[model samples]
Every structure is written in structure tokens, then in C-alpha cells.
Target: MKLQAVLFDLDGVIMDTAEFHYIAWKRLAEELGIAIDREFNENLKGISRMESLDTILRHGGKADDYSAEEKRDMAERKNSHYVSLLDRLKPADVYPGIRELLLALREAGIPAVVASASKNAPQILRALELSELFRFVVPPDSVPRGKPAPDLFLRGAEEVGAAPEFCIGIEDAQSGITAIKAAGMTAVGIGSEAMLKAVGADVVLPDTRRLSLEFLRGLLSA
Candidate 1:
């Protein structure tokens, strides 16, 4: 199979915005008198904002405490905090091998697209100054569902005019790996190998630093 396009998950795959997200969420949880730890934050990865909020509320046993409008307000508040943190980001914040891999893909005439669940994806790309490297950043609202569902990845391949079988999807979350597999694309996972493998990732790398154009091509060839 030929590699037609590469679909990327933004937060952990391209950079480390996951920590910013954790900080924001932790702040929100504290405001609600709920406690959350890093291990719990892992469950929030690769999910929508509303979904993450819901998960947090459930965890705190306060799911029924907020009205729908109150929940929206809380989510907005968290996003505001997250966006504020993003101002600290710069082009150099991109992970070790990501920039080089993206450039290599460009040189090889391969297209890349962001398939993140984050509504702030475009802003994040702009912060990293890597907006031009990707053909499109799939809008979160455009898809009916987020990670752990195939909608986003499927739409990403469609946007790039690539069939799912001919695409490679890279993600740092198990939910995202599941989405890639569900979309019928090869999954290149970043982060814990066992966790990603359990979710059916085709190949698991420890971090973005290990990603390379040659490694990607090898996946397709194999």
C-alpha cells in the first residue's frame, strides 16, 4: 500500500499541550471542589472538551450538580484558562522529531492534516508556526463525534482525498489509536507502547522523537 496522507493528533503527537490541558482542567476541578491527579487526567486525553468536563464531573461525583448552561460556562472558563496558557507556546515548543518529519513529508510530496479533537487546533498550529505544513485541520464540530469514534480520522482522509487504507494516522492517546483503526487507517502511536498496542495501534513509538519519514515509509511497505 502506498502512503497517500498522514493524519496527526495535535496535542501530544505534535507538541506537549497535554500538560496545559491538565493544568486547565485541574484548575476547573479545584474550583468545583474536586480533586484530580495526573493519572486521572490521562482519561481526558483525545476527547472533546465537553466530554472531558463530563468525565471530570463524574469523577468528582458532582455530575448532577450543574445545569446544562452551568456546564457550558464551566467549560468556557476552562478553555479560557487553557488559551491563556497557550500564549506561552512558541515554534520551538514542537516536539523533537516532528518538525523534521513534517519537512520530510513535504519533500516527498506527502500531504499532512491535523485530526485533533481540540477545537483550539488551528490556534495551536498557529502558535507553533506550523500551520503551513498541514493541508487542513479538521474542525471538531464538522465531525459528529470525537476520538474513540472514526468520524474525525475518516473525515481527515476524505479531506486529503486519500482512502483510509492508504493513510497513516499518528496519535498519542489510546482513544485516538482506536479511532484510527476504526477508520481503517494504519495507526502510528506515540507514548506508552502497551497502552497503544492494547488499542490496536499498528506501530507504537515511545515519543515523537522516534518518528521519521523513513520509519513511516517502512510501515506502509511492511
Candidate 2:
């Protein structure tokens, strides 16, 4: 089948907001009396905000210590910190070649969708001034489950009226790759070839800077 739509992940794949996420996560960890590093942050990628907090809390052996309300409060605090950091974002914050790729997909008559786990996806899109570029932007609240479960990407395809086999998903995290595969779409990984391959991505690119319709089509045909 011909490719009908492309689904993108928001943070590490579309923008360099990983730093902001890490900063907020680290701040929350410190306040919660836990330790976190960049390596630990890698585990948080492509997951929900509450899930990220839970992961760090579990790492600190404190996951079961907090009540549900307390956990929600912590997540909210982290989000407030993250929202404050978005002030520094601009169109320039978009990854190199991302806008061009979106434009190319547009010129080629392909619909693009963003399937990020971030609940603040809409705000992030507006901050980057790329809100109008997508056919559908899947909000985190729209689905009960996030990446690694296939719900988000599947919903993206559904919202765009594309069949799973006719959709392509682009992501920079292991969980995202797993989700794409589970959704039965073409998985395009934006990171190291070895890591992406290990996670079962159909095609892996070093970065979006190398993305082209020809390369993608060839991969699909292969």
C-alpha cells in the first residue's frame, strides 16, 4: 500500500527539548530526595509524565511511599518547571531538517501527525510555531496508555484515517520503536543504527537531516 501518513514523536525526535525534560526531572528528583542522571533520563523517554515520575521514584525505592495525590502533585510540579523552560523555545528549536521534511511531506501530499506522549504537546507545537503543520496531533490525554503499548501511534493512524500498514512512525526512543512495531506501521528510528535495530525499527537513520522521500519509499518497498 502507498504511504498515507507519517507520525512523529515530539521531544527528542522533533525538538531538542530533552534538556528541558531532564532539567525538570532532575529538579523533581532532588526535591523528592532521589538521584538521577542523563543515563537514567534515557529510561524516561517516550513515556508519560506520571510514568516518568514513577520510574524515578521506583529507582529510589520510594514508589510505594507516596499516595496517589502526592504523586500527582509531584508530576504537576515537574510540569510547571517544564512549562517555564518552554519560554526559551522558538522555531529554531526544531531539529535540523524537521521542518523541511514536514514541508516535503506536504508537497508530496502526505499527511503528517504527531503522536507524542507529552500532555503539553499542543502548547509545545504552538511554542515551536508548527501547530498547523499536522493532520492530527494526538494528545496524551486522548489515550490511556502511551508508547511501548502501541495505543498512541495506533490512535494517530486512526485520527488521520490511515491504515496501520500505510503509516510510518518516526521516533527517537526505544519504547517508541516498540510501539510503532506493535502498531504494525513502518518504524523509522532517529538515532544510532545498532540501538534502533535492536529495538526492531524497520529503518534507522542517524538523524532527520538525512530523511528523504526516496529513502523512505525505498525502505517501505524493501
Candidate 3:
């Protein structure tokens, strides 16, 4: 099979913005009298901002306590906090080997794009100074649904003019792996091997440092 495009998850795969997300969500949850820890934050991964807030509410048994407007306000508050944290990001903050891998893909004539669940993907990419490396970043709003629905990854392939079967999607969340599989693409997970395997990832590397063009080509050849 020929490699056509590479779809990347921005938060964990390209950079470590997960901590900023966690901080923002935790602050929001605290203000709402809903206790959220790092363990609870895992459930928010690969989901939309509203979905993450809803998960927090449900966790605290307050899912039905807020009106739609109230929830929107809370989500906005979280996003504001998250965006503020993003200002601290630098080009060197990008995950090790990710820039090299992206450059290798570019040199090899392969297209790469972000299929992140984060609506602030463009801002994050620009902060890392890696905006020009990708073909394009798929806006979260462009998709009808988020991870586990396959809309985002499918859209990434569409944007790059690649067939789903010819694309490779790298992610760090279980929901993302499921979405890639649903899109009929090869799922390369960049986190816990067991956790990703449990979610049907085609391959799971320990982290982005293990990701490379040669490693990806092996998957394509398989």
C-alpha cells in the first residue's frame, strides 16, 4: 500500500499541551465544586471541549444541574484558561523527534496534517513554530463529530486527497485510535502499548520519540 497522508493528533503527539488542558479543566471543575484529578482527566482525552465539561459534570453527578448556557459559559472559561497557558509554549516545546519526523515526511513527498480534537490546533501549531510543516490543520468545527466518530480523521484524509486506506493516523488517546480504525486507516498510537492495544490501535509506540518515517513505511508495507 502506498502512503498518501499522515494525520496527527496535536495535543500529545505533536506537543505536550495535555497538561494545559488538564489545568484548565481542573480549574473549571473546582469552581463548579466538581473535583477532578489527573486520573479523571484521562476521560477527557480526544473529546471536544463541551464533551470534556459534560464528562466532568457527569463525574460529579451534576450533569443535569446546569443549563445549556451555563455549560457553554463554563466551557468558555476553561478554554480561556487553556489559551492563556498556551502562551507559554515555545518552539522547543514540541515533542522530541516529531519535527524530524515531519521533515522526513515532507522530504519523502508525503503530506501531513493535524486531525486534532483541540479547536486551538492552529494556535498550538503556530506556537511550536511548526505551522508551515503541515499541509493543513483540520479545524475541529469542520467535522460534525469528534473522536470515536471518525469524522475528523476522515476529513484529514479528504483534505489531503488521500484514500482512508492509504492514510496513517497517529494519536495518544484510545478514542482517537477508535476513530482512526473507524475511518479505515492505520492507527499508530503514541502512548501506553496496553492501553492503546485495548482500543484496537494497529501499532503502539511508547512515545513520539519512537515515531519515524522508516517506522511508518514499515506499517505501510505490512
lDDT of each: 0.93, 0.89, 0.92
Candidate 3 lDDT score at position 14: 91
Clashing pairs in 2: none
Q: Candidate 3: minimum summed lDDT over ten consecutive residues — where?
A: 116-125
Cα-based TM-score, every candidate: 0.98, 0.97, 0.98
Query: Model 3 over residues 10-124: C-alpha lDDT tens digits?
Result: 8889989889999999998889898988998899888999998888999999999989999999999999999999999999999999999999999988999999888898888
Residue 25 accuracy (lDDT) in model 3: 92
Model 1's TM-score against the true structure: 0.98
- Compare candidates 2 and 3 on TM-score and give the better one: 3
Per-residue lDDT, model 1, residue 102, is: 92
Best by lDDT: 1
Q: Per-residue lDDT of 1-222 in model 2, one digit per residue for the tens?
A: 688899999987889799999999999999989999999999898889888988999999997999999999999999999999989999998898888888888889888999998888888889888887887898888887888999999998998788999888999999999999999999999988898899999878888888876667777678
What is the lDDT, from 0 to 100, of the residue 42 in candidate 1?
A: 91
lDDT of 3 at 150: 97
Candidate 3 residues lying further than 4 Å off, grouped into runs, are none
Q: Each model's number of backbone clashes?
A: 0, 0, 0
Q: How well does candidate 2 match the true structure in TM-score terms?
A: 0.97
Candidate 3 positional error at 26, Å? 1.1
